[model samples]
Target: MTTSLAPDPAPDPGLDPAPDPALARELRRERAHHDACRAALARMAEDVAEQVVTGEDVAASGADAEVLGRHLRSRAKEFGEQPPGPLFFGRLDREDGQSHHIGRRRIAEHPAEPPLVVDWRAPVSRAYYQAGAHDPQGVVRRRRFGWAPYSAGDTADLTGLEDEHLVSGEDVVSAIVAGEIERPRVGPMRDIAATIQPEQDDLVRSGPGTSVCVQGAPGTGKTAVGLHRAAYLLYTHPQRVRRSGLLVLGPNRTFLSYISEVLPALGETGIRQSTLDEEIARHEVRAVDGEAAARVKHDVRMAEVLRRALYARVALPDGELALADGPLRLRLPAEVLAGIVAAVREEAPPYATGRERVRARVVRALQLRAERRAGPLGGAWARRVERARPVSAFVDACWPRTTPEEVLAAVLADPDDPLLTAGERAAIRWAKPPRSFRSARWSAADLVLLDEVAGLIERPESYGHVVVDEAQDLSPMQCRAISRRADFGALTVLGDLAQGTTPWAARDWREQLAHLGKPEAEIVPLTTGYRVPAAIVDLANRLLPELGLGADVPAGVSLRRDGEVRLCRVADVATGVVEAVKGALAREGSVGVIAADEHVGPLTSALEAGGLLRAGGDGGAGGAEATGGTADVVAPESAGERLSVLPARMAKGLEYDHVVVAEPAAIVAAEPRGLHRLYVVLTRAVSRLDVVHGEPLPDYLAS
Candidate 1:
């Protein structure tokens, strides 16, 4: 376990050296180590599969044998598949002279042999990411390995290595971070395990019990940090987290797809990734709401209004509860029944639970009345009395059954309902009530209300941890919906307050935390920009004053300053976007042409008609494209067209090497928080930002 401060020796003098002998030797050793780890992992997989096969025999003898067999077979298949990626990315040298290789997963040899690769979440591997000159934490040097493009039937090439002397006070700035940030964008997002900065690493390694709110600017690696934190918690607290589960919630489906691979690349799987709407609705939604209606639905005041409306269904029975059995008859006076309903109401349980309590109370009263009259009546008589039609009818009338949808429909259908006050009624009433529950159309924001009501009726299942990205866009009730899912667990809230782009978007982090039921959670700000360059960030910051973020505006510093921000006034936006996409496609990485939602159709058509863009099926299609009126092109990485026409609203938490923003003014005019939306679009580029506007830019950007 002896560690070496000295670099690896040069290649043998007699052998022909490839480029740099020391680097070549290191790569060769690392490759051999990778091969060993792969062999060990194969053996581990074989052992796991064998265990599953053995368990199948035992499970076959049981009544639920088929169910158990299916689960085992699925697990065996997971163990058998070898995902492509580097075996390890870093090596940490501890103060006790121990060296540990850090990778996406753990790998070990026989009991006699030491572990070949330690999981990145291991405590000893923390130095690989957090160790620095300021706080070496008992580390001498840290090494980072670089990988070549992955090819079929082979693991990624371990081509290069970078070293940092944590205790030597040596400058750490090198090609390692710059190269990672500048790496060509292909397919979904890759893990930042090898390039995680100290600040990001701090958040990733936070304690499991500590909830955190990361206020990170674009390119600060907030999403990556959040995902990695989930992986870390799963690895460190496997039993606790596995039992409660973990989830990563994003702003939209496209955003979810964009970051889908990050967790798996870090050797974590089965972690649920969902959009807020998907998580809330849990089913297909065919309805759409206008901006005004959506805003009212998302308002925080709706919580109080909905609460009153749901409880309004509860009422005391007007008559007595009378139960008759063969030779025995029991009568509970109306006042007694009223008292029982009052007791349950005083506890204020869920509306559904309250109904159950009232039914139980009625049965108890019948039993007591029968026993007093007959001097300990037989069990048969009590059972028959409880099942009497009169008792059932009374309970049904006192507390009628209802669903979340039914309650919501009733409230919206009646403007003068007693549950709604003057202001609440004005804010939530539908323009035209549906004729029936089957005809009512529910909007995305309405789904949050449904979720709220559902939770009030029956407590929702909670998770071990919840990582919410693009949190600034979540309305108060939406936050509450998410909060309910992690009542006993911690949360990792990630977003840029200045990037809030919804009508009911939060004005401050404090307000958002309060709504999420984690007001005491620590708020950490990450201002450094690693993905988007400084030049582009500066240009985006100009819109912050208009956003009214005040002191919370993030100051971003990029690792590389070689990025361009071009603002051009064009006669036609569609033509300008097409030209911009063509120029960006000619570059090395992925390109995105972001425009207002209404403009996506025209731009998509323009690109398709010009034959500059091809349609991609995997991208979540909406608006005109969903109905097949126009093609919304979003070419998959393998399609060889590294370009996508993205709606501006879907642009948050996504980064492209080159970005073309069409009509900033139009983006601003599309919603009440258009200025904030424009800011988000302006900062989506990693290498370059091209602004193409037919109309004048927003006032802040214009100046």
Candidate 2:
């Protein structure tokens, strides 16, 4: 279907067109309804606030009132969470003349009554998004509301509305939806519940029991889709979700902070938002991993090696011993004990469980022999035998229990482990092996290994649902870590394979899903680019095939036609970047200046030298309010800031209205997957991309 994406028409000063009275009346009516719902929600929160937990709420067996009180308080907070912006975005009229407004959340006068505004994820509200001229789905007409990008918590921000009359076969080229999608991202990311496409709706409404992976292209809204899916699950399955819990994982802390507001805006509060690095931080990462060492440490093979090393610690007895009572002599055969050890190993329980199993079997074996010899002794006899010094000593000596740190340290420090190659061993082994694992400095990859070993000892805590963004760059070992936490639940995986910049990034979604322990999860592709302009997407599309993602790596089509792309060849790249920033700042969107990790300082210096204020970290620089300066170079995590200068790596899950990339060749030369890194930062632009470089552009883009 063709779409008209012309920018908002500018009103003329010379001529005043006749005002449409119908539109004005309808908008006023809608605004009044929005105000009423806000009032109703406030009442709801007030009512919940007055609630008191009593004996009826808990059992007489003495349940904790404090726990119940917290639950009630949290529920009240959910009702009280009224984020700024449009509450309800669309209206759907069924064939039977019933009208329903769809919004980010449900709003009703009372708990037992039908909602005044249906939730966007409700089954009935699906028609508002999926209905078209051909398939109305019982919807006679659908109305879309247009509002200001950022509102001041007032209904005055409601500007215009559009309608689609399905029965009359009226197709809508919605200027509001296009404008919202094209709106510049300023501070933290916002919810897209109002503008979710049909394809995205399908993924968001997927069953809570199923694991699904989305191989979305840049600007495909995959990150937002994952967050929405999580909110959907929390809404649909409150008990099943909160029973174990829900987790949302991003690539880094900045990305997590970027998306921290999306779920809360959807009326979901207190949901755990974290990065993968922060999740498995068993110890402080005081050391960095060399390339070869990281490979060995994050290798899937290391999991098996850890298991073997842990189990090998169990010692088998050569001969049985005699259990001497005060006046009795008891003897057991060595083969009988050997049988128990063999059986437990074959059972393949967790390391801790296996040790207990062997001990229990050994004690039981001795008890049976004693009972048979003594001819039906009391049960206390078995207890006595269990606590007997001989039995305890034998079990402790053969079937030993150990910690993850102890086992891993021994495996790495072992100079003669046949499972590891000489080079592999040397690379991963600690140079100055500490006297204890507690005092040792662990690298990031080492923490992943430690997680694997910990899982072997006992299962990690499980979540009902897990959402991981930037998943294509997950190493096999890292995937195993996520798989452990979500073993009993399901995962909603989101990423773009072409944007994967890690050395161990999976080329195939199938491989990545397999490592995630969800091989059967459906691989869904979202190739439609909405946030990115077509020109920028086209530029990134040229570099896809070179990343070895296979022939089927589909090219994305940007729905935006008005996106701007420019190439600036300059003698000084820094100077060019400063100029681009100035131009981007002249407009009303966020500006991002991304360069190789090593070049961030030089670029920031250039911006500062060019009279731009540096809005940086807590101690280094500040935001507009902090610095009280205009044209600031901001940090990505600084809320309400308009400009961010970040390294290429931090650009993975972020977007901006205008992006100035310093050098393509330098980005490519930064790492082995440098080409993919270049592809990521290039596509981060929502409206325009300015390539400022002293060196020649990448071959694919140049051609």
Candidate 3:
């Protein structure tokens, strides 16, 4: 069935060209020779299929493997790499009188017009070979079906392709491959090492590397490609890679929810997904048994401050006070108490002064007073005070209580409190503030709360892969905890060194990464950014170095559109935010506005008035509550209703159709590490990006 279309050649003009009749006959002979080769190819396919099904080695028997190998090697030699799709076919005379080997194809490059070489052994292969050949002049002609862009139908057919046809990129490679047809390129391929890029696809298909790092720039389809690659690996090598071996780590739980449906869409089960931080939190809070490395390191503390604060607010009375059940009545009201405490002990030494000393004194005083005044009036007041104690203790526990009031008084007395050492001040700074100890105790409690939270990491079998997104923002200690959870599978860390700020340790994350494994660790760097348009990325790159920082935005960024990177100052923050909102909504649909902190009251109002945003729950800066509301262009109340207006700190590893960076000037002026933080926010947009400033950004960003 092969079609031939050879244009008529110019007739010879020379009178001596007497063999016009003879040349035509010779051309006919050449066509017949090609036809015989095609028939022989079909016979070879039949023999190959029989041996394949019999489980006998095809190469061990007759010319089956030889004939096919010659055809493929010839094509590979000429074409540099064979085009994917029934390279050979086999025909079988079974009881039903027909036999089939599954259809197989390749997704590779082809230079110029390519020839078809079909074998007739397998049913699908025979379809190509059975198309037949033509005696058109001296040249042979046939049509070889080539793979096109994956359409919905092709994606459907993928599920039915034979396993052998689903070879890995590594399995089929051509350093000098040539093809006129342009190949579709996507994903984070460039970030990986060059030695591996040409073959990574192959490795992915085979599933050999213990760890694979897909270091993708913003919007480079890192997540999209990773998801599809995971599916591809599973489908191609069903026995080697499975949903169980694959794990996709996003930035947070909500992120996990966002991409949860990709795999099922591709007709494959979705792989495991979770946040790196929560996984670490779960490990520390639920399994920690041994004491942390530093029981009390001022700055290098290994404690969950947020978790501890929450526990002190609701579960304990007088966060700093410790007592046994015999004296528990002094700590809680009968109604407010969850249950009678059997016993309690001091885990850490009593605090040095202020609330710590006061709380300890009250615990003892209340025990004595309550024991003596066992009657009605005294009992009622004690109960009320105890009930009020938890709330009072909660407020106090959140602020500094360890500071000697006199010392703080001295420090505050002077605008320049340089005399106080940073360590001593920090120690006092994080301690719980003073609480009313009429019923609440003042002493700092044992480190038991922290201990309870640290026990979560006792075992590591619960996870598959541990991937840390936005890793450059992480502290070394946080990185260590993340490494501990990789026991179930391998570890893949993604980060941009330019966004890091640790002067001493952050300077060399690669060295710190060595702590996780050998020097040859699977590390990859994503240079190209697909998030912002070329224009934005170029502007950012040009402006970043002017801040006097050596890190320029990577050159790989492409600003595909003409736009502005102007700094506008408003009469006030509100006015500036309003302008920013107008710019963000110009694109319509959903937009995201990230702030510097969780306190988004001012920005929220401006966005609402502009009819650009909706709000979600109040989960503080790093909490889970995304204030839910409608983002109707007409009435924007909640974050859900309006464009996404969030703090800049919370925008890591996220994207939006459009992004408006609110208050860059205040962020640069106020944050201790604003330069790096600001850059991170600016890179969150996949296409359109805006930075709203009430004042000019630091010279670095503005320049």
Candidate 4:
């Protein structure tokens, strides 16, 4: 199409010459551009919402991309234009009619090839912080801090206060107690460019608030805010909040490692972190039980010796069983049986008698060999031997009256005793006995909130600000523990109600927490997400619920236009893996592979052994060792291959730049808990997202 050429209009000398004609023309052009940009923004918002609702990733549409570029271009011109008259439109109609273009170039031309249409304003943009506060005054404010410094004695110095001796004089004691105060620990603060959404700030800063239940959507910075609040508490109420008094209950070891540095970065410390399982096990076994529990080992070696020598062909090899048969053969007195039972009840590792002990060893040796072949039935046989009655009433009475020495002799003399079942062979094979593995000692450290943790929270020296990040994953049991010990400090709990990973326990944690007397809690809801591209977030919100995951968050969380969500179909399961691997590499995404347990082994093997993918756990490409860097596997051992290739049950509260859900078909057959996990995996993507497998995409995503 030919462009129209118009002759320039001459300036009038009679009009007020204060405003230059060229400047006026530029203002007029900027206004037209600004109005167009605004309309494009409004349209982009509407389009994103519609696509999200209709189950489409916003980045998949071309018009959405064009609009984003135009909006940016228009905004830049409006702000940079010298004569800013058009920007200060006097009437609402004129301003409303102006078009807003975001691109740096002219709207009439096509955006540069491979157009950058990312809406920096969208919470999902990587450049979000660069957008900064809209107020020009705030942008130029001087920065007063730098990165935090690390010190070796930081933890030790704080803990050393316990060793101090107090002065006894009345005047001196009063002065020391009243006037002596520790120096405040101030850390460097990064310039937060993105304006903290006004509503979010209000929710976080409200006073002595109720137990704040912040149901944050994924990518919404729940953990970041929780840490920030702790820093804020330390700043505002230094007396009420201290570093040592704070405790954090996380989901697992990985999460603990993931958020370990946040508090320190904010110039605070003393936040205790641990998993729920470790805390519970330790508390129940040690402080609660008050007994040193060890594995029970029975004493009956002598019985096995006699049984083997007397009836080697017919005797059962289970030594514990043969030992039980010892009592039957001996016809031990009831009083004597009671003695052995009493010794067992006392949990004596080594029984008292030396003579009987030798016999018990022989019996144990034979039974151990037999049990290896007979399996768990060995224990059952031993119980039967102990319970059997004597052949006659007088015999029983006589047995109960017998001494340990007498019982031993009686058992040795009668090897073919009634306790030996027919067709059972007594075989005594002397081999090395299996040593019982000691039960792992779980730590009571994280159990600071548990009632049994003596002086944990009640102490005046504890941490002052406690934050429970990912609070939704915490169970009532966990919350109880957190409340008791954490009560000594201010509490900040953040999580998304929709993505409660531990619903089995947390289903009632809310009520349980209320009963614990934390009724006036601040419940903050973050409706916007600034992590994933808007397209990715929109897809997640729309389809996540269909998969029985996440809360009903608004589409604003992912209202951006620069990221794409695509589904790649593979010719077969194996081919699917290759496609996923290729696509992930092509995008330079830190790839994540998620599958069912059944598929984890094969998929992981194929990816690692076949040299198609790296072999590591949850972090990123560098996770894999130097086997060959074609793919860097980022998997941790405790997390297992399932963490990298398995379903969502293992992937909750985690994210990756690119997530490859390998076997979608398996998700449908998964249990409710498993299904929830699958949903978690699907939604944990940032930029490029795709699902590949023989199975179907989650119903929500498909819908």
Residue-wise lDDT of candidate 2 within 660-701, one digit each (tens)? 999989999999999999999898889889999999876788
Q: Model 3 scores what on Cα lDDT?
A: 0.40
lDDT of 4 at 295: 6
Score candidate 4 by lDDT.
Answer: 0.42
- Give the higher-lDDT candidate: 1 or 4: 1
| lDDT, residue 258, model 3 | 51
Q: Which regions in candidate 3 have their CA more than 4 angstroms from the true location?
A: 1-207, 212-217, 225-229, 236-245, 280-459, 462-464, 500-505, 542-555, 559-566, 586-589, 611-632, 635-642
Q: Which candidate's lDDT is highest?
A: 2
- RMSD of each predicted structure: 5.1, 4.2, 20.2, 26.4
lDDT digits (tens) for residues 356-377 of candidate 3: 4333434445546556655333
Most accurate candidate by TM-score: 2
Candidate lDDT scores, in order, read: 0.76, 0.80, 0.40, 0.42
- Superposed model 4: Cα runs more than 4 Å off: 1-195, 203-210, 278-463, 503-516, 544-556, 614-647
Displacement of residue 62 (Cα, Å) in model 2 is 3.0
Q: Is candidate 1 or candidate 2 better by lDDT?
A: 2
233-323 per-residue lDDT for model 1 (tens digits): 9888987997899989987766777787788777777789887777777446767876666776787777877887788877887877666
lDDT (0-100) at residue 3 of candidate 2?
A: 15
Local error of candidate 1 at residue 466 (angstroms): 2.2
What is the descending TM-score order? Answer: 2, 1, 3, 4
The runs of at least 3 residues in candidate 1 whose Cα sits more than 4 Å from the true structure, single-residue gaps closed, are 1-20, 59-75, 111-113, 150-156, 282-287, 325-328, 368-386, 417-435, 570-579, 597-611, 614-639, 694-703
